[model samples]
Target: MHRSDSRGVFDALVVGRGAIGATAALGLSRCGLRVAVVAPAQPAPSPLDGPGTWDSRVFAMSPASRALLERLRVWDALDAARVAPVYDMRVYPSGREGAPELHFGAYEACVEALAWIVEGSNLSAALGRALSFAGVEDIDARVEAVDCTAPDHAALTLAGGHVLRSRLVVGADGARSPLRTMLGIAATERDYPQQAVVANFETGLPHRDCAWQWFGEHGILALLPLPGERASMVWSAPQELAGELLGHTPEALAERVAQASWHVLGGLRVLTAAQSFPLRLIRVDRTIATRAVLVGDAAHVVHPLSGQGMNLGFGDVAALLDVVARREPFRDLGDALLLRRYERARREAVAAMRLTTDGLQRLFGDHTGLPLPGLLQPLVGARELGWRFVAGSSWLKRRLMAHAVS
Candidate 1:
């Protein structure tokens, strides 16, 4: 690597240019920080045969996340047609006969919409476009080494033998982030032993902008509305089950999904082949290390059943930007005090979501046995009460909705 002695110069260096990384870079740059983004070369787009080898994941943008994207000037570039607004959400607990299903809608809260479902590709592209327009330096190289021995500056070595220095390094890389490792930050990871099978299809009936979730015996399945008569499905199940699903022909798989989801979308036709990803709960011991901070999956990853993974990362971006924006002129951006402020702002929310999603996944995924007599009634009643808790409180719902838009 070409070593450089340049010190105390760069405002920040962001590693990874995926959705979270790109958004963080854009946020920092917009706050007047000279930022450098190091990202892997963009992979080729997927063919019509199946879900792309490159991540074809879609994200449900909460209101707060959307606002943050707008502030970064990234959301406007997205094609409106490709974006689907979720006006309502239906959640069902499997095998619960006579139990009232829970429903949430934007109208109930007097909001224009609850959230927007957008493809990961579109959001990434939009962020890239915004970054280019903002004149942020893009270093299309992978990081080989990182040194944060010095408090005022952290040094990075790229694969191409170029050394770059920055006041702060942000790890917005995905779960297995190289930057996180380079900084020696420990992560607690729990494999859910389940894989999420995702795909897109055309439904016989239009989704009407409603998102549905079914807590099935095997696992949770979510059908997120897409534009037109299309919708995206995420089926979380055991690895063996996922393999069985993957073994089926595209048409057969579509049929299986229809059955699993109780044919919620009517007759389903696969527009894309199914692809599976192993589900896991990962949380870094801390989001901040000396001279660096972690964002996105690098910081934490929860069950996708709630669709809060990316939104959590966006929360980090927002908080970090706010922290930096308020820093005094002479204070180092990577100073412990500044980093602690960012950490404090994020810990409570991240911890709450992690515990909440993890608890729900375990509770519903249990196939042990059903209760009897009085116990069963209370159990059913409690489920209904939980829904009431969610539906009754606009504060909680609005807080969640706000996260999606940011």
Candidate 2:
């Protein structure tokens, strides 16, 4: 990597080209500013070979995320046939046979839909086209160094010795962000004892555009609807259970999942390979520093059980864009005062999501053995009572139904 400064200064330089980073670049370009995306060279996308070949990675995008994508002109660009809308959600207490269920329906809440389940590939394709059409500069190179000491601009040294500078550097990179470390930002992380096993399955019964989740003793299980008679599964299982499941053949895994889901959608057939990833909660102390700011997983991470991790990241993108768009004419993009506005707007919401997911994990933690502990009984009873209260109240249901969708 030679150290020659080839690229000129830009209004903003975004690091990482994942969904959040791509969206950030697109959103900033709309401000009529020149933005450059610094990331590894992207391989050409291969054409789909057959019908219904879906990516294992999927996200249940909240309403807030959808609106932000729409603002960036990406929503309408996505393949509508492949997207699935969730009109209702059913959540059941774990480890209980006849526990009361908590339900949230968009119709009852007077909303169009609760959330949309989107395939990762569809999002990548949609965002990819938008980025090209938006005319954001793409510098395909590995980052050699990050220099933020400059008074006016933050600079990045590429492997080829090319230098890229910008008034503001946005880190929309995922967790383990090299940009976050390059900026000397530190994050606090806690490894959840659970690992998420995710896959797609073709269901015997139609999902009816509803999402189902069960809090079981082994872990939290969710079945998110997909287009047609298909559903995606996110089984946040204990480490031991995850290991066992990963060892099963596709047919065996299908049977296990069917039994666990109580055959609600009848027998299931695997549509994608089973994949597992460890769960964790991560929080960075500062989202913004001198001439630099962090967004998405680069800033915060939460347990996948709640399915709000990505939504929280999208919220960061929206907040930061709002701050930049509304900045006073005299203030630069990296103005400390302006970045603080974005950070402040995101703090409360991020903290709430972290606390909720962590609390739920602890509340339903494993207590199984030869004989159940006496204290565990009351805990279960209390959980049941709480469920009854929440399920019986229209206000609480509405309140929960609005979670992270704002």
Candidate 3:
């Protein structure tokens, strides 16, 4: 029987049915919590996989993320052929020729691969199906308001006039999380002065299952491997450079990209419509507020150049699940103390990621200057040094990978 507390209408009600929210609902349900998910509508039918159906939205899922998905049983559900293993990664220094590159390989990390490049569509389809199997109730409506102070203190009022109650509310919403706002949670944000232009391309040269990144003069370009000589591109460029990129026609874009990449992949041919989004670092001082907690982009977002955004969200889910799993039977899920455990657990990891990504973005960014005080090095000098240190230190990389590979 459900507890008689107002939040006991259900153990948790997750607002925002994006990938993060859906994943949260699935994980909590699997943990034996009475879970309900609120979404704008039932998920649209997943498209049938076909030739020339490559999705532009791709993620380089870290090994840790893979474990979470595997544990959730969503990893194997995705069509295996659609995924590409990132056996190697090469990162070049910005605007430098002959600089030693920082490289990561499966062998170095003692893992099968550094990460897996997965299509957003493929993962979504799998997670959607998994949510149902996990027995999470689906509420098909938009969340217009969330009340954390009422008889059902954590009640969510839907746009359609339906009210759903829960002992705890989780905001898996994106960067602009309405649920976060409803709980009066504040966050620190900094624009990277960059925008990401993403798309799919058929490369003249095979990627060899390698993910490559070039820190060029005006932007950071990453070509993540896809099957059969295809790769996905994420160019995090300055505002004007991003505008220039978006203005180019497909053929022009390919030509420009190939030139920018120094013909690393021989040549490039656009295979899909391009997409762009501004980049920013969002950090919440506290992820928990009253009876509600935030996860995924709702809690924090870092620069995508590191390709750790999705992985970080998965980390958030994993951490939250761990806290929930170890809670005392007598402790209510929404207990302030129970919620603080979740906050403390995540604070350090989240802070390190923010500092790393934000620091790197600023370093390689068009901005001039060293982030350190009284450092008399030119921008070029610092960038080279950073790359060299990463390239030189196996122990450092392995330690980093331990946290990264999950």
User: Considering every candidate listed, which one attains the maximal lDDT?
Assistant: 2
> In model 3, which regions exceed 4 Å deviation?
1-8, 42-48, 150-153, 368-381, 394-396
* Whole-model lDDT per candidate: 0.80, 0.84, 0.82
Q: Please write out the lDDT profile of model 2 over residues 308-342, one tens digit for every residue.
A: 98898899989988999889999988888998899
Reference-based lDDT, residue 333, model 1: 91
RMSD in order of candidates? 4.3, 3.4, 3.4
Clashing pairs for predicted structure model 3, backbone only: 7-166, 7-167
TM-score of 2: 0.93
State the RMSD for candidate 1. Answer: 4.3
lDDT of 1 by residue, 1-406 (tens): 3767354468899999888889888888888889989877888555322332222378888888888988887889986667899999887776666555657788875667778899887776778789898878888889989988875688888887778899999998799998898888998888886899998888888788999887757788889998788889888887778898879897898898788777878999887678888899898888898889999999999999889999899999999999999998888898899999999999999987786677656556534333323312334436545545555667756754444333
Ranking by TM-score: 2, 3, 1
Q: For residues 1-406, write the lDDT of model 3, one tens digit per residue.
A: 2223243489898887877888889999988889988877765744746777788889999988999989988899998999999999888875688888778788978898999999988888888899888878887877787777864358778776667788899988789888787778888887777799998899999899998888757778998999889989999988888999899999999998888777889889998768898888787767998789999999998889878888888888898899899999888889888889988888888877776666666666546553532221233456667667667878756755665576
TM-score pick, better of 1 and 2 = 2
On TM-score, the leading prediction is 2
Which of 1 and 3 is ahead in TM-score?
Answer: 3
